[model samples]
Target: MKVLVTGAAGFIGFYVSKVLLNKGHDVVGLDNINGYYDVNLKYARLHELGINKEAASNYNNVCKSTYSSHFTFVKMNLEDRSELPKLFETETFDVVCNLAAQAGVRYSLENPETYVDSNMVGFLNILECCRNYGVKHLVYASSSSVYGLNKKIPFSTDDAVDHPISLYAATKKSNELMAYTYSHLFKFPTTGLRFFTVYGPWGRPDMAMFLFTDAILKNQSIKVFNHGNMERDFTYIDDIVEGVVRIIEKPTTERVQNNELYKLYNIGNNNSVKLLDFIKEIETNLKMEAKKDMLPMQPGDVERTWANVDALIKDYGYRPNTSIKEGVKRFIDWFKMYYT
Candidate 1:
């Protein structure tokens, strides 16, 4: 099947796209390659996929640049409605994995408009393309943060997500709602995956794992948010990609005509780990003690998050296997090699 993967330069996007390529699917990747973090990391991810900075310097989308035959990439912002539709029309995708968005909770507080433009406006454009192009399955990334300030131990899809503390979480929740509306109106099969704290090799710098690793390596104090009281379901990147593959291959069937095939699942380890414990794992792996600056929780930050991925397991047999200690070790090892 011909698959379209948005945010192909991103951590999850790169891993997922590689999986698709390995499976022998024709994939057209799209990403703006913004300087949200280090632009070099994005380019590095692209380079791993056979695209270089030279080919991805401007906004023009590059096609078939990789030595591998099955994958291609385009440099385009999803919010650019005009060009987005054109690309979708030309590609005529069978499956589209929409992972593109303005990520980071703290960043959302600083730049709320970006969340609106990319998460809301950009996602709307993707939905329009999926509907118009007759795409079979649209698997999107929804965040565990969408559970918001709910006082729940294990966040479930059945739980109400009305109180989003951060603009980022609100946008993710909004994506699920918009997808539901599109699925109802156009009868498109849309699956929204509520990703927990995904951490592993090639993870984003804005995320905790990378930040802590970098800080520890530099012998700087890592801010232990919520005074080290926070807990997160730090899932491995491989597990997240596995769930995505399972759903994309098996597009849900709408029970009746004129209705869309729509479902949502929480993809995570289903187990939460403390911030301090997570830090310890990183510190141990790197053989360096972390200078911890324990601090109160910032705005848009949650006390804890644990995903109840029972629905995922039931429907798609989603199994997340990487433990926090093991996952952190893998990341630290990669960080040492990549940086050195």
Candidate 2:
């Protein structure tokens, strides 16, 4: 199947594209390569996929990957209404995995418009393109942050996600709603995966794993948020990619005669690890003690997040089994190799 993977240069998007290409699927990757984080890291990810940094920087130009005959990437924005439709019209993709968005919850607090432009407006364009073209399945990236302020032990799809603390979370929640509407009206399958704290090799620099590793190696103090009283379901990238690939391959089937095939699942490890314990894993991996700065909880931050991936397990046999220790070790190895 020919697939269009939005945010193909992103952390999860990069891995998902590589896996799909390895499976011999023709993949067209699209990303604006925004400077939300380090553009060099984004370029490095594209390089792994055989896209040259110079070629990938060109706006609206499609660059064929040297790594795989089945993979090609385009430098474009999801919110680009004009060019986005043209791509859709030309490719007529069977499946679209929309993972591109203005990521980072804390960043959203400062730059709210970026979240709206990329997450909300951009998602609407994706839905329109899917509807106009004959796209079969539309799988999108949602966030566990949508389950805001809920005291629920394990965040489930059945739980109410009406109270999103940050604009980023609100946008993610809105994406689920938008996808549902599109699926219901246009009769196409759409699945939203509320990813937990995904970490692994080539992880985002802003994330806890990357930040702690970088600071520890540089002998700088690492900011421990919530005064070392936080927990996260740290799902590994490979596990997250596996769940995505399964959903992309198998579009949800219609239960009723003509019901909308819309499904939502929490794609996570189903286990929450303490922030301090996670930091300890990093320290053990590096064999270096980090200068810890125990800071108060920042706004738009949650105390804990644990996903109940029972639905994912029941339907797709998805189980995120990578332990924090193993995952952090892999990341530290990559970090050392990449940095020095």
Candidate 3:
């Protein structure tokens, strides 16, 4: 199948595109290649997928990766409706996996408009494109942060996520609701995946794993929010990509035994680890202890997040198998090598 993967230069999207290419699927990847963290990292990811620095950084037309003839990339933002439709008209994508978004949970406190434009408005455009282009299946990213300050031990898709602690979470929750509406109205099969704290090699610098590792290696102090009391269901990159590929391969059309096509699931390890323990793993991996700075939890931060991925397992055999210790070691190894 010819698939259009938005945010193809992103952490998850990069791996997902490579997996699709390996599976012999024609993948036309899309990203604006914005300076969110480091454009170099994004380009490096594309480079791994056979897209060189010049091609991935090119902003005009789509570049076919020299790595895989099956993979092509467009440097376009989802908010740009004009250029967006042109790509849709040209590619005529059969499946769409939307992973692009303004993705910092804490940053949303400072720049709410970014979330509004990228997550909300940008998502509307993707839905519009899929609706207009006769796309079969649309799988988009949601977040476990949508659970907010709920005291629930294991947050389930069945749980009410009406109260989101941050604008970022609210936008993700809104994406799920909007997708459901489009699915019902246009018969568009959409799946909203509520991802847990995903970490692994080539991960985002904004993420705790990367932040902690970098701080430790540089001998700088790392802030421990919520005073080391927080817990997260940190799913690994390979597992998250695997779940995504499996879901994309088996479209919602096949899962619909009756008439329902829209589905939402929490994609997580189903194992929550304390922030202190997670830091310890980093220390062990780098063989240096983190310079600790204990602080109160920031606004828009949750004390804990544990995803109940039973719905995902029941529906699509979703299983996340990487332990934080193993995952962090791999990340530290990558971080040292990449930075050096």
| Model 2 pairs whose backbones collide | none
Give TM-scores for every candidate, taking all chains together and pairing residue i with residue i.
0.97, 0.98, 0.98
Superposed Cα deviation of residue 326, candidate 1 (Å): 1.3
Best by lDDT: 2
What are the lDDT scores of the predictions, listed in order?
0.88, 0.93, 0.89
- For candidate 2, the 10 contiguous residues with the lowest summed lDDT are 251-260
Q: Model 3, residue 198: what's the lDDT?
A: 93
The alpha-carbon RMSD values of the candidates against the true structure, listed in the order shown, are: 1.4, 1.1, 1.1
User: Can you write out model 2's per-residue Cα lDDT over 238-301, one digit (the tens) per residue?
Assistant: 9999999998887455532457488899999999899999998999999999999989999999
Q: For candidate 2, what is the TM-score?
A: 0.98
- Per-residue alpha-carbon lDDT of candidate 1 for residues 1-340, written as tens digits (9 for 90 to 100): 9999999999999999999999889988899988899989999988888886787877855767565788889999889988998898887899899999999999998999989999999999999999898888889999998998889789899998998999999999999999999888887788899999999899899999999899988989999877898888989999999999988887466432536467899999989888888888887888889998988889888898998988988877767978887888888889989998
Q: Report the alpha-carbon TM-score of model 3 versus the true structure.
A: 0.98
